[model samples]
Target chain A: MSDSDAQNLREVRAIIARHKLGDLIFLVTGLLVLMIAVLTFIALFSHMLIDGLPRLSWDFFTSFPSRRPGSAGILSAWVGTTLVMIVTAAAAVPLGVGAGIYLEEYAPKNILTEIIEINVTNLAGVPSIIYGLLALSLFVHQLGFGQSILSAGLALALLILPIVIVATREAIRAIPVTIREGAYALGATKWQTVSDHLLPYSAAGILTGIIIGLARAIGETAPIITIGALTFIAFLPPSPFKEEFPYISFEWLMAPFTVMPIQMFNWVSRPEEAFQVNAAAAGLVLVIMTLTMNALAIYLRYRMRKNLKW
Target chain B: MQFPVTARRSDNTPDSSTLGYNYRRHLSERFIEAMLFLTAFVSVAITLAIVVMLVTESLSFFKHVSLWEFLTDTQWTPLFDNAHYGILPLVSGTVVSSAVALLVAIPMGTITAIYLSEFAPFTVREMAKPFLELLGGVPTVVYGYFALLFVTPLLQKIFPELPGFSLLSAGLVMGIMIIPYVSSMAEDAMRAVPMHLREGSYAMGATRFQTAVRVVMPGAFSGIAAAYILGISRAVGETMVVAIAAGMQPNLTWNPMEPAATITAYIVQVSLGDLPHGSIGYQTIFAAGLTLLLITLVFNIIGHLLRKRFREVY
Candidate 1:
């Protein structure tokens, strides 16, 4: 072989060797870092779980909280979280989905529309605490909702609205324009086409989006904390309109409530080891709830994608 | 004569008649469309209203305390009788902790991204990405709890004077929490690089590592930078972790081993207790929040702009 050919071969081999070395280094380091992170995550949870699980029973789920750490259960917080999630979903879905449809199908392509799109994108990035502040000023103070679950849900609904709108728009946009054209050809009105055909087709995607949004809202603490979600509540909230309402005639709307994270925060911040265990148990419950919701959403999205004929 | 008879019959049929039925259908369609528009309008109005209200309240706050005092003052004793309005300590704490988090996150996150995109087997890459993302999905409060219970104790075992809650503990946890943010963004950028570049380097006898480090990384630098900045924004805005893990004292010191207060932590601390509205202490929370909002907003805008500016057409 020519000297040049031999030299080229040698260089190629050296390059390959160096490449292998680099890959090894990168892979080892990356895996190490990830292992560290995952281990920390497990350790953190384990510390809580190990100490708290024996204490956690059916009664813990059913019982009211107490100043005595051992007797306290997160029943009020659990109830509060459920009510907030329901109210937030109710308020967010219609408005978010409607706004999404309009943007995707009916809105004019103009600078104003562009501005609104940009604004929504930016809104998704705004800190959750800012929304809490907004809720405090507008809902709690001005609207006289005080520190009620209604105010907290409204704040959360607003926080997740941008995500819902974005996801809904994507779902709506995925429907073929040919479907709308086909409806038009059949002499069906635009509204009928959207309601009867398009909405149903996009239903699964919209549902997945709503679930994801709900998960995010449920995990959020800053906004609710900002809105003065009580850190401790011994009693479950009465129905929003019941006569035994705590404060204003809109007593349900004015009553204070604790959420899972806020409760966890309160417990974790306490100096006692026992409270730390309680925080872990609460964290475990919160994580399980969120993960289950997310898993359901993923399953629904898979089914939707699979069933989409077009 | 037959066609004329048929046309007359069609006109006589009310449902088949074009004018009245078509007009009514058009009106109803327009009404629903109008309703959809109204919903869109309301969302826009809500977002704008929030911004307007925050700014208006913050403006009232500014009137009472000069911007210089708010920005320059190092002591944050708003709740106490001796109220020092300086926001510097909180600002410095936020910056330092976020900086530390970025220090740990960027190299590791970028390398992981590189490995996933260029080096790792497809199965490995797929599994790693989602598993890393689980970190992001974990609530910040959990991270805070972990930092306090797990990380702080572990650190104390090694460094005896390490405060039970220190900035290092919080920063370390924050860094772990943001790994997914950085890795996912960086991976997207790396994936966006043209395959031809990698192939060409390989054909020229460059090894995979060389191609990735010299060609792919430089090609994806802008995107990686954007990811890093976004991670910083997330760390800065993060409240629960820092609030719970990094102690509440707004000390001006730069030591990572010491307990320090960040802006978000300060807000959390103050808001936990009942401070009536219009009090200087309560207003200070808004002031600190405003500062945090502006910092994050600027970072987000810059990151967005960079992504837009450098977006590869192909």
Candidate 2:
């Protein structure tokens, strides 16, 4: 070959090599970034496990919180979390589902509908603590619920309302338009169509949304704190059931309560080394609860997406 | 020839039973619709309630403390005997910590998104998706514990003088917590870039990396910007990690190494302390909360507008 031609060939190879090197560098960098996120997860979990595993036991689940770290357990915290979740679910589901149904099915494309849509989006972006302020003013003071389980539940219900509404709308929107038309052709009323076809079809997605919302609510501490959840509660709310004429009582709704995250926060803020261990234990439990809920929601979503042919 | 459908039905429905049944059905349907509308309106009610609550309480606060002092004062000592009401210290702490967190999250999250969307195999993507979800799913309180008890000590080893409650550790952990949010959203945006665009890039002999950085990144720029804005909102609104790991003292400083209270942590501190209702101390939290809400709202609006404006129909 001529010298000029050989030189051109060499320069072409050099350019290709340079591009290939850039690609390789980016590949390594991307892997490192991914690893950093994954490793943080592993590290956070293992750190809690190492510090907290020994603290998890039967006594730990049975006893109430105490000033002494050794005997302090999460009994009150767990019970409160459960009861608050019950109230939150009871309050949020009906309202959120109704709203979702209305927006997706009944509402026309109008200015009012647009306003409602924008409001839901903005509500979702509002900080959790602001919800606490709202609850403190509207529920605790005006509604006279005080710093009770009912108030906390109502606060969280409001906090997660947007999530449920969005999830329900997305799930409803996923159903083919033909289904709605088919129902209408059968002379089914709007409520009847929604009750029979739309809800049944979208039940799984709605449940996933509720579970995820509840999971988020359970971990929320600032709002609960702002609404004044007692940091050290030694007893559970009055029993939800009664032996009297009425087999069920709602008095527990008015009783004060504390939850898991607050319990962890309380312990973590302590200066003692022993409290830190308890905090880690509580942290482990909280993490497990949230992660399990999230995992279940994700699994349900995946299965729903896979199974639903439409 | 001009008879309407409703008039025809009315003329044909002669039986009393049919008329009664239709009337009952109409009444019930109307009732149900009203109920549904009311439920839908509850969300709007909530927004209104939040705005009213914050503004009224903050108005009460401003009555006690001038808006000028609240805006420009550097010290935030509502509970102290001297009782300065400046919000700048908290603002400074919030800005510095969020800046630190964004520094860590944006680059890492963008890189992770690009890798997952453009480079990772299907199996790797599947594994990473759940892993990232779990990472994000961990409660902020647990993150606070990790930051305080684990990360802070580890950092102290690097810088022996690093305080046990430095903003650096909390910000780092908060960034880690936010990575999932950024990466997932950005990945969705990049993946939404039409396949033909990538094909065109490859037709010109561009490598996968080049295609992602050049063609896809620009295509998804608005979406990525939205994702970053979301990360900023989350970092700014985050409470528990800073409350537990960063000191509650509202020091007006920009150094991330020094401990200071963010807006969120200050609210938590005040909430934990017992201040009677209607007290200036109590009202201070509302003012702080209003500030926090306004900051997040601005970012959220920008993000929403960006997503709306640049959403590719293709």
Candidate 3:
């Protein structure tokens, strides 16, 4: 080869090396950002856990709030959260699961069904605050629910309905078609086949979805805030229903309550140092609850996948 | 001709009792089907309700303020006396923060995805996947606090002029919050790329880096773009982080060291207090919400369409 040609080849190789260097820089920077994000989460949790442990005794779990920071336990908030979850689940499960079953099994593949599917997908991404506004308008002002747990729960239920339905549909779809065919061959009706076979087969997955959905609902603050869940309720919820009389009636549902996230928000917003500490503590509790629910979901999903037979 | 008349009639007639049973069963099935249809109808109703309500409220808002003033004005002092109704500053803040976040998130997330999918061992990839998802599962409020208390302080050490609640800190944390979203989607896209393409590049004596950069990355570009758009939507609609870390100042400055507010943050600020019905300030919140909702809706729709368009048939 000529000397001039060899020089040209060297130059070309140098340019390629520079380009490779740039790619390495991009890769390194990207990895660094991800590392920072992970570290931030770990730091926050560790800080809260460390600061919160000494104060987190049995009394913290059982007692109600007091004038002192050390004295105020999250019992009221705990019970209130449970009440909200129960109410939300009670309203959302039947409606969401029924919708899922309908869409997956019964609904015709038509324009209307298409619209419904798109709407549900869009609803999943709608800002939580919008749901809060809807709840405020329809429940608080129009229906005269007046900032009660029922309104908050109903709003949350609506917020999570799309997610639940999507998950439920996935679970239902995972069931093989032959089971339904077998039932049909046995002279069983459509409803009978779904109820006796499909539902049971998909129960574990459905439960996992419900649990995860509930975890999401529990962490949600915007909708409940919009529905005016009390920032600090001194009293525990009376019942899950709205009525006082007719013991099991719906009238007991209209009682006011405070959820854990809302409580954390309220406390965090306060300028006082005590409230900040309280907020951190409350945050810890909320995280624990969410993590527990998440763990349960993972466990159930694993179990379901293992037991699922093709 | 010799057969008895009753026996001949019975043989010729259909079984009436069996027919009655079939008719009842059909009716019951129809009823159940109708109930199932009702459930689907309810989902539609929820969407309709949100759209209708936002439109009505926004219409009321537009009646008082002209669209030009709402969109063009630089100052956004809706709560104070002599309130100017311009939404530009808020929009600028939102855009700037989201852009900064995307700048940080896209490269980071895409690289991490590449590393996990292409480079990492199976065990390392398995451990890292959940760790990345853990970032997603953390509540936004916690991120908000962390940004305000931790990240802002850290930024102050570097940029001494940075305010207590500057756009830089908020943008950084928001970027961090969005990393998992982009990474997971990009990973899925990269994983979907046909292995034959990579093998062909390898046969041509391409280095691993060269193949990833030229072949795999280009193949996954559409999915990455979709992830980027969705990440922007999340940043735009994000409330708690911007509300806490990005100071509630509607400044039209481009500098990241200064305080600024976003549309979602502005809504949160307004919604905290009691605003009487029919007031311009209350109406403005709805107007702002309308803008936010529309912008995000557009992004989401575009992202969905792009994903559909570029989806690999295989």
User: Considering every candidate listed, which one attains the maximal TM-score?
Assistant: 2
Superposed model 1: Cα runs more than 4 Å off: A2-8, A240-251, A303-309, B1-18, B194-197, B214-223
A128, model 1: CA deviation in Å? 1.1
Best by lDDT: 2
lDDT of each: 0.82, 0.91, 0.79
Compose the digit string of candidate 1's lDDT tens values, residues B151-266: 88899999999988789999998988888889999999999999999999999877777898898988887888788887888888888988999898998978899888998888
Q: Which of candidates 1 and 3 is the stronger one according to lDDT? A: 1
Question: What DockQ does each prediction reach against the true complex?
Answer: 0.46, 0.67, 0.37
iRMS for all predictions? 4.4, 2.3, 5.8
Q: Across residues A1-310, which tens digit of lDDT does each residue of candidate 1 receive? A: 9999999999988877876887778778767876776786678667767877876889878877777888788898898999888779988999899989988988888987787787787787777888888888889888988888899999999988998998899999999988888876676666777898889989989998898899889889888888777787988776655455453343455567888999999999998877777888888888878777777776787688788788
lDDT per residue for candidate 2 within A50-75, as digits (tens), equals 99999999999999999889999999
Worst 10 residues of 2 chain A by lDDT: A181-190
Backbone clash count, each prediction separately? 1, 0, 11
Instruction: Look at candidate 3 and tell me the lDDT of residue B134.
Output: 54
Question: iRMS value of model 3?
Answer: 5.8
TM-score for all models, in order of appearance: 0.91, 0.97, 0.89
The candidates, ranked best first by TM-score, are: 2, 1, 3
DockQ of 1: 0.46
Docking class of 3: acceptable
Q: Who wins the DockQ comparison?
A: 2
